[model samples]
Target: MNPFRTQRPARRGGRLLALAAATVAALAPALTAGQAAAAGPAPVPALDVTSYLGTWNQLAAVPAPFNLECARDTQANYTLDPQGNVAVFNRCTTWDGGSNEIRGTARIIDQVSKAQLRVEFPNVPFQEDPAGTPNYIVTALGPDYSWAVVTDPSRLSGFVLSRTPALDDASWDQVRGAIEAAGQSPCVYLTSPTTGGIDTIAPLCTR
Candidate 1:
């Protein structure tokens, strides 16, 4: 009558062990995702700010609440100020056909690489928080300054900027490669509208 008692206990233990292994397997993907999310992107080896100044069209970006008001045609114009700081003027088209513009200042944080910068937009709420610091790293750039990719250390924000409103197939491919290399998921980015001219609504890029 009690001959199967010991076998029952062994079977139960085996089942418990199997369940634990299954649970770990189920959680493996989530663990890997968390690790990837926490790992920051790598910035370009060097950045020449002198050649980086100019108007750039937004090709794609990881959506941010700060830029939520923008519907399409996002762009940024950079110029060197007399004090050696970079003047920033960002503009994007609103849903109502008007444009939203913000003025900001950018200072170099890494003198050697010149790829890291800190940007501040005065009067902007979260963006202007004095206690918080946001990283601006230039992760990629075109040889002739035709396009650039900007990202943060947190990988929460990213932007694909081009000197022109659009890039050719080859250039776009290069931009995608750079985005991936920067630890960003290209699938997560939404293409910015850049048609009917800058600051106007147009067809969106194919994902």
Candidate 2:
């Protein structure tokens, strides 16, 4: 046996290392940690809120740095897919006011609670190699389920998605009241930018 024959194994190890690095590079976007723990448990809304399902227009949200790239009119449409998961179609106007869409799948972490769900975009990447979690809990449902206040414990991301683009004056007050009761500062909410940069602000709920 030649003294340098062992070097052959070393070359193979290098190749394996390169492949592993490549695999990790491809999965960086899908990986997230400490997300599950941040959300805690989904709170039960006081009213029968199930009727709130359907297409919801993003009328307003917190102006966070992460979502700055999303233009006004950013909306999410949730539908049931054949695979028994929630199909999420998120559309937002680009900075230049052009339409952009990201299709994703949402799986309920706990079906019975129907509170927390993981949303993954570009489902194909997940099939190849599921990595970190991108989306996490930010808010919980109100008793009526007519509206929900999603927020992460860190309070970095929050959404006030409703069943319709505009809640009636009475309903609007109820949403604000509920959010306040939950101990969140309502001032953080800003109207979602729409076409032509219109802010459809809702008056604070009186309830």
Candidate 3:
């Protein structure tokens, strides 16, 4: 299950709570960020799919029902298949200390930038793209490709991924800045658990 579906996430503690000077939202809706717009940036112009293919740590994300059972260690791995399509493999650990996974295929829609892609899972039933929406958009990426910010065309979901489980203060700042630059709210995302992970599900926004 992808982490970008519709669902409200609960909070977590530690530095997140300490840094989260803003009060908690008593009830966050399924869609917490700004609606999609034609303006702002996404589909970064210089995404090298070759450099992007590999494992990425799901540091934070918008809560989704499809990921409800996932407790920790959420991540995604991408590989290029013989047909030149990106293979999508997502996995997470369950609360009962189990594991869950789903495999899918992604077709690059933006041939030029290769930042926008339509992903579909086998027997997953999310493929009826009547609206012709792009499911995966690489909105932002670190200069060194150390981190990335991903969301859908509609901005319905958001994810902050990194090469490692935990990010430094500078990287976190960069991630939040990237989200804002992409015309999306960082609050829409909550930290995911990982090895040396944040250990909290708190919103990324402080204000």
Candidate 4:
């Protein structure tokens, strides 16, 4: 009956569509922030490779199938080879009181920070690609080279290493923060066995 009556429905539909668009626009920043957070934080800018050399005890790690054989007392020893590659020696006590050791090679992939490395072990097929993943990133380090935190880009693997078998509560807290900053939940990591020392057997450490 009114001239604007016919236009009412069309105007209502237009208003609904405008509201929807405004809602999406309002959520755009939040959605983008969530995506960025999910992408994870970047790796540390620099690493002192010389001070990082020597022995490190595995204080904690995200469980991986490759390391399932290790029951406790997990440790890694790194030394520079003549050709500038890093000699990697990893050892852990098995469930049957025996020891398991693996020797590998680590090549520095990032020359600037030397924090990124590609590790390869002959006969061990962990990665499908022969070139390996350049995900081994050193995310954090202790003030005196007493502890370090390593993680990959996927956040699937992480390791807390210490110069000694045990770390102070403050250091552990720092490690937890670092792990979280790397976009990983610290609760996902299992405390590695170090009660029996670096190479000793302790079945309880497995839990």
Score each candidate by Cα lDDT. 0.67, 0.50, 0.74, 0.67
Root-mean-square deviation of every model: 17.3, 15.6, 5.3, 19.4
TM accuracy, model 1: 0.75
Please provide, for model 3 over 1-207, each residue's C-alpha lDDT reduced to its tens digit, 9 standing for 90 to 100. 263231233342233433333322532342343443346356889789999999998998776556666667889999999999999889887666767788888888888888988888866655788654678899889877899999886676778888989888888999999888776777767778887968866677742
lDDT of 2 by residue, 1-207 (tens): 000111122343344335434433443333223332234324442322235446666655544433444546777777778887777777775455555566677766544445555666653332332543324352445344555676543444457776555666666566666555444444545556554434543222211
Cα deviation of 45, candidate 2, in Å: 5.8
**Candidate 2 Cα errors over 4 Å, as ranges:** 1-42, 45-53, 123-145, 194-207
TM-score of each: 0.75, 0.59, 0.82, 0.74
Candidate 3: stretches off by over 4 Å? 1-41, 130-132
**Runs off by more than 4 Å, candidate 4:** 1-36, 128-132, 196-207
Going through the candidates in the order shown, the clash numbers are 0, 18, 0, 0
Per-residue lDDT value at 152 in model 2: 45
Query: Where does the lowest 10-residue lDDT sum fall in candidate 3?
Result: 4-13
Provide the lDDT at 181 for model 2: 49
Candidate 3 global TM-score? 0.82
Q: Candidate 4: deviation at residue 98, Å?
A: 0.6
